[model samples]
Target: DANGTTWIYKPREKTAVMSRIPLLPYPMILLEKYERDAELRATGKLLPVPSNQKMNAYLKEIADICNIPKNLTTHVARHTFACLAVEYGMPIDVLAKILGHSNTNMTRHYTKFSEQLIGREMRKMNEQMFSDDVFLLNQ
Candidate 1:
């Protein structure tokens, strides 16, 4: 029997590792409801895990509904996750581990930073190192 947490193992990596992902309270409750309605066991794997082809087809439909211009695929979702995580201030090392990347260099390839994000980070650095006193004093 397992608890509310699960580990995702990447055996194909050069160095195999497991990532612990917790099921937050709201999702846990929904999962419990699904289990009860589906008559699933604690040990049973979740059902209706769609195949890659089917998942890609569904993603295409979703992209259309969202008015996205690019092709959507599983790899695209991975890149999206990487981009969002970095854009939202997740550390590169932590993102690397979450992405099952063996090195930060590999993880860097997956993340694309926007010019605005770069400028924002630079501005934050400047604010931290300098103060308004450097600008002007009370007249």
Candidate 2:
């Protein structure tokens, strides 16, 4: 028996790695699993999981149906997760591991610091260094 949390991600000829998906999408994942099983039962063979290209096409159709103006793709979701995870105080090293990056440098490419974050950090630095309660000592 093993933890049901992770599955290997094999991208073509690249290295396969075990990845954990956040539980926020647990319901959707369960639904997909149910549908996949049903599909297999209905047919002799299982339908392969949709490719990224097909999934993107489906996303575009969904966006059109929902009257969403922006182009929706898997990449957009990954970028959103990268930004939000960093903004929510997840450490860079931790995030790199979560993202399956071999090094922090790969994760850095995915992470973009928002202007709001920059301003917030700057304000924090300013308060810490120059607040009235803080004594500035030249060493």
Largest lDDT belongs to which candidate? 1
lDDT of 2 at 33: 71
Model 2: ten consecutive residues of lowest lDDT: 5-14
- The lowest-lDDT stretch of 10 consecutive residues in candidate 1 is 6-15
CA displacement after TM-score superposition, residue 131 of candidate 1 (Å):
3.6
lDDT of 1 by residue, 13-108 (tens): 445566544555775666656765443555465434578899999999999999999999998999999999899999999999888777899999
- The clash count of every prediction, one per candidate, is 0, 0
- Candidate 2 local Cα displacement, residue 40, angstroms: 6.5
Q: Tell me how far the alpha carbon of residue 1 in candidate 1 is from the true structure, in angstroms, after superposition.
A: 16
* Steric clash pairs (candidate 2): none
lDDT of 2 by residue, 22-120 (tens): 444665566467665766767644344588999999999999999999999988877778889988878999988777887999898889998988888
Instruction: List TM-score per model, in order.
Output: 0.74, 0.62
* Per-model lDDT: 0.79, 0.76
**TM-score of candidate 2 versus the correct structure, residues matched by position:** 0.62
lDDT of 2 at 118: 85
